[model samples]
Target: MFQGWNALLASVWGCCLIGFTWGQLSDSPDVLRNWCLDSDYHKPQPGPEPQLFSECSPWKERSCCNATVSKLIHHNVKVWHGFQFRHCPPQVSSECLRFFRRDFCFYECSPNLGPWVEFEYARKSRQQRFRNVPLCASECEAWFHACKDDLTCVRNWGSEFDWIEGTNRCPENAKCQLIRDTYADAKDFCETVWDNDFKYTPDNEPCMVLSFDPSSGNPNDNVTEAAISRHMNSINSMLNRQRIMERSFSCRISPSIAVSRGIPKLVCDFSFREFDKMRQLKGKPKETPRQKKERKQDFSPENQHKALRVALPIFVGFWVLIGIFIYLNTRPKH
Candidate 1:
């Protein structure tokens, strides 16, 4: 009777174990089947064998088995994370916050930031200056005269007259002369008389004159009215100051003017012989007569024909040999 009781207890335990495994497999049949077929599942099959947990299951034994669980949890957490919740830390100190907030930080937080602040400031400053005092043609003329009084004014002064007229007014130290002509003539005159260090003034016509030198003492001795008039007529002929605020306004605003004029053209007289000598020393090498003749000979039709004749037979024989070998091998291998 004790043996019978022992058998019954054993059978009951075995039944319970089998029922538990069946329930587990039913709960996750796909995972279980994949686990069974998995290369790492090394238990012997087709016999009475113990069931094992899948790597994807909570009961898995190896740490590597936990990878799927970790991945799932990470994906769930990431889905809930929001971008707006991420805020930048404040960069300015508390002491500087008042001034910085009033003047600087507003720009820092902007999407595009303050890229054009300096340019805007400069434009505003210019606008304010223009509002305070405006420039006029008369003012521009006054500025011109003031420039003449200074020993250093040459091409820097405004040019308002043709070469002849300017010569009459410019200081003697300024080598003012006029040359009547077209642009080409003016260029030639400049090269001839002024050694190319000169400028041109034309109300609407061509004229040329030496550039004034301010550093030299009184130019009147060397300059003559005839020279000025002659050059002016030769080219085409033509002729033709500031303040501050009250006390600050009382200050003499410096005179300023914009002068646009053409500079002189100097003569470039180079000899062909000298140019040729330079080419001989520094230019690229030239092909020799013999090399040129040889190149022509190599490309002649007879040579091409000779080369083709030598190559054709050899190429034909190689292919014929290959074809024969293929036929012999592929013939039914009895």
Candidate 2:
């Protein structure tokens, strides 16, 4: 009888867990779409960080790290992963240090790292990480050139740094060397640091920025949404805890993502056609499957200009049709 009772309780617990997982997946594709990483570090959701440090301010509009974390990141007093930038000769120059700080800013603060987030299978602490995020060639070249003359003891900051006394020190018998000499070239420099966390993309392409002019609108936002939209479409089928394919970063994330799971994604602006379809759905009684699918596929804002172009015509035509119908109905038995 005790065995039977235990079995029943286990079954009930499993079902409840499964229900919770499905609930997260069934949420609005838009809300379910954008998220931060699930770790000791990130916030439950990305929101305004108005008080973020000036160096990390570019992400203030939407950030994973709060003001406290931003402040921590800016201070050299906070030792990260046992790293010491001064582990080599001729100390990291201010220009080169700025580049490193910007890189950390993006990793620690930006909500835009969504597309590349993945689980680390072999990691002992098992923190999820973003992989192969694209960096603009110009930025990569600039980073490389800025630090080329500076010295670092290791080629891969992720794996090779030898931690000691709560900070990194040069490995045994390893000599310090110039950054340019440490890496083969600009592409090699970008890819090899931190074990291929970044890939170089040429200018005018849809690469991300470590820093940007936020006033003009963020180019990376479009890239993130497009990738998320693709992930959403593929997840249409029910995913039980076992089958793993790709992403997410809130409690909104699933059991599968709790393990090593990820997917890279596409980049483009949201589309206006989707905006039109969404508008039409307001107050509708029901929708056909085709309509539902169309709505799902239309991730928002393909282009800001395009949305305005499409929406304005619909607004004008609706008024024009109303005028014509009113005129005909009022005509003398026409």
Candidate 3:
């Protein structure tokens, strides 16, 4: 009984699987047909074929009574009528009929049909051999104008608000302001606004800078630049004030002569002197060793004493050697 139950379950599952597979296969065409129901999706239906009849009847004449005559005069006008006539022959085949049905369905019932049928298979053939034709200057100019307008709109929208807002248009709550200022001031304002929401700076000396060129073709150029400028200036001024308040405490530098006499000072002085010399010799070539050595050297007493100690020993040794050589020469007679 368990084995029978297992068999029944297996059969039910198999049937379900088969049904699912069949549904999957059939649903594709149904879905496509439903999609074709949309008004925009148009496809042409296949046209009806014209009917043909024989001009003369078989019983009209004795000649028609002949088998060959009957065969010649039968419905041979339409090839689908089969080759019952001798003068005309039917070219119809089972394969041709199947092909025609399929071809008709594809070019008639399918969503791609209108354009395909209007252009025929030549449409696909042309697309396959498509060449990238260069646009004329006029065409490019027109496209550029359209692209420029779109880009301008996008830029305006992006600048006006954060992306959270759906519409590209600016919110009514925010008043747009414009200020013209030096590049430096403008940069300071922008930086302040970005870092600390709408702050002022010492550079808050705002100028009325035009956001868009009034002379340019943009219509939005007429919009009040002053409002934006004031907002920017206010932010800049706030930031500037904040920065000033933060730095209000004076920085004290303790007076220390010892620090002035340090290695850093020596290095700085030496570098400064060298820089001055270089400047003096500007456009002049470097001096030779002899020219450089011509400068007077100021030796301190200690340095002079050290130099004397080194030279005195060498001088005394030279004198002793000379005397010994003279004595040896004079004593040669001994």
Candidate 4:
């Protein structure tokens, strides 16, 4: 009776454990899909800095195993807010600039305003591949004329604001329309905003003189200039980062190819290869049916002996328990 009871308990436990394992194996596909979706679909964020190459130089176009290359390729990096406004190609309507201004400007552009920019992803393929396309110059000009004096247009234009409230305050329909349509309108606004002031501002302007005076040996002036230089460099770095992000999102698989068009030296020479190596270290390859069978057969002979070596102690303990139970039951009345 004791032997039978011990056998029944072992059998029940074994059956339940096997069933659970099989259920998990069958649901593997769903698990994998969920995992991929979680890991791949979201906005890319800044990751750990890649290994830097000492041999690489900014002036010289050469390749080294820098981790920044992968981040740039994947568009998982950040830059200065001011970089977007730099190097505007006159009369050329840039889709990159347009999209960048529309979506990212509120966060990165002006600090004084609130969120008011109304932007949507362009559906057309030509617009998506916007390089230096022509924009609505006439509409842009007309809109700029009306809003040139309005505080919101001049001060809070590129910054941020409530769309409904701000639009209502605009003096003219054209001003509201251009401001809402950010791409071409933004370019025209930026161009004309400072145009009138540039000619009137004399060389001896107090603010300009203190900042640009070469002979000023004052320590404060030197410090200010150095700070300005660093700020400019940061903006330049952000510009490069922006280019890579745009290209990566635009062409997910082969972003390097698209980005390399403008930046000849930034060809992803080793980033992908390094990324693959990193993946292989962390990722396991799925086994084929034949491979699974081979793995199962590995339990024969020496493997069986190895298994017995481990199971022998557990088996001994089980029989000891059964023997004690039988002894306890059969003992004389006490």
Candidate 5:
């Protein structure tokens, strides 16, 4: 009876363990499953995988990156040059603006395959950045096509589409130098680079970041300009601690902007080439080659002669008047 009872307990425990294992296996996320099938479907080779996956070449014509990018572009972007700023007031702090740009790019530009996909692909390879070149190229190409129709989008592509290094073609990664903050060094001069979390902007800090919850499969679902505006406005008010710049933007989405309450003080210290591009957009048009040639021609002998002709009579009249005045003074004095 003792031997039979012990055997029965062992059998029941074995069944429960097997059932739990099966449940876990069946519960894999769709994104992870899709990535495995798409990215890792191929058989392993003896050597390292190629930096550029030529197998994905067939996907070039298919806008694979479109779904990922449009998550932000479709809603956050207004007609070409504008953003869904109904949530963000013009008086909002610059920190909120940096947050807006960073959040948009982080979600949109990130490799659609999965997180750390770039790092994984490049781990065994010498050129890590080149590991997912094909995918990167495809994303850039898709953005180029999407923005081609809008002048403001095209012009601001440097900041707007800077994820793929602002071009469809493979570009050399720019090396960035970390500026040593004198204020920081005053506390302690450490030889090792400090892991300064505070130095990072809110978008860079995941704890402070507010990402758009993209609905599954359907990029358009729950994504609207009004929704995006409402979201941004809420974030802006939370960060605008001083209340000096906490006015909300007006839009049909939210008729009255409410002041954010009890949010942690957040600072915006981020700058992008895109901001400069926007400033340039507002500034004077660039001088074209034709304009430069015309300007050069204006200084030519022929043009100089025409200008001199107009000025010679005035110059001569002024000298004559001066001479007459001198003569009159001398004669009167005599």
Candidate 6:
């Protein structure tokens, strides 16, 4: 029993280190790494796992999830976090549902989401989210074709659904319609269904596919690494160009804008090359690259506070872990 507690205490300390490391990562442009969400289901870090189950098997060589979660999400469960597929009368088709399962497997298991990882500001707890992930055009087409005949009432599955008794139900104002009727095209379906989590792309350029044959290769690995490299080169080029003046972005929130829809937007002119790809998504017009120079703010006070919030808990936890370890080992035992 004491030995088990020792391992548990050690794990808590490791989580503390991860918290501090991630806080530092936000301030440092040179460091990016494969990361998993701080979720109850995810492992601390991504690594090789050879025995993942069913549709999730393709990620077995490198995954953020274990076989237990893969099996649970595939077999023993049909709903997660109050979301379910049986919102319409005819219900979702098996093939269509399988496509969704594969997508979930990718989201929960693949560590390649690093380049697009962002924070879920809406959640009180710290959680990582993927933003504007570019999906291979073929997979989007395939998913849409399979599900077109199925029924749904909402465009955005992430936040538009209504839940009752812990399962999703169509909103009171919504009437079920065919998936094709709900979304204009595969691109629209991919982009809006998850509220911009995925950006559909027609280009043959390296993009992520939800499911792949392991015998061939995992394109996700190549795609994210390439994006990171491209992003680094872009950053280095910008710094070299601005070495004398050090240009950076300064965004301001336009809180007084009347007739604003939903959340307020932050307005800014600064831009980066890799971020340009996402501008092409959802019919958003791309802004011309600007060369105006502004002083780069490295670790502002607000960032310092954020770092402190992350670090304070870690510091307390480390001492607490040490205390527990010492108590267990030094205390008299029968």
Compose the digit string of candidate 1's lDDT tens values, residues 1-334.
3234435545665575455333122223223222221112122121121121221122222112233333332333221112110011222223322221211111111111111111112221111100111112232232233222222212312222123421313334554322132112432322222122223233233221111122352121122232334433532311100000111111111111101111111101122233334446877646768999999998889988898899999999999999999999899987
RMSD of each: 48.3, 23.0, 39.4, 25.4, 30.9, 27.9
lDDT of 6 by residue, 75-188 (tens): 744575556787787656889989988988998898777777777776433376777888999989999999999999999987888767877888898988999999999999
TM-score of 3: 0.14
lDDT per residue as tens, model 2, 138-158: 899999999999988789888
Whichever of 2 and 3 has more TM-score, that candidate is: 2
Sorted on TM-score, best first, the list reads: 6, 2, 4, 5, 1, 3
Best by lDDT: 6
Q: Give me the overall lDDT of model 3.
A: 0.30
Selected candidate, larger lDDT, 2 vs 4: 2
Q: What is the C-alpha lDDT of each candidate?
A: 0.28, 0.69, 0.30, 0.33, 0.31, 0.72
Superposed model 5: Cα runs more than 4 Å off: 1-281
Per-residue accuracy of model 4 over 1-334 as CA lDDT, tens digit each: 3334435545664575455343122122222111110112111222122242221111011112133432332242122212222221122134333332222311111111111111124321111111111223443344344433222322333223223421312223323223334434545453333222111122232111111111332222222243334444654565454444333333434555545545332344333344445446878745768999999889779899999999999999999999999999999995
TM-score of each: 0.15, 0.59, 0.14, 0.21, 0.20, 0.63
> Which regions of candidate 3 deviate over 4 angstroms?
1-298
Cα lDDT tens digits for candidate 3, 1-334: 3334435545665575455343122223323222221121121221121221122121122110223322332323222112111111233333323322222222112221111011113221121110111112332232223222111111122133333322233344544332122112433333232122122222223211111122342221111133234334654664443332222211102113323433244544544455445446777746756666554333667778899999999999999999999998888583
Worst 10 residues of 4 by lDDT: 108-117
Which runs of model 1 end up more than 4 angstroms from their true locations? 1-287
lDDT of 5 by residue, 212-237 (tens): 33322322112222233443464455
Which stretches of model 2 miss by more than 4 angstroms?
Answer: 1-33, 121-126, 229-334
**Which run of 10 residues does model 6 get worst, by summed lDDT?**
244-253
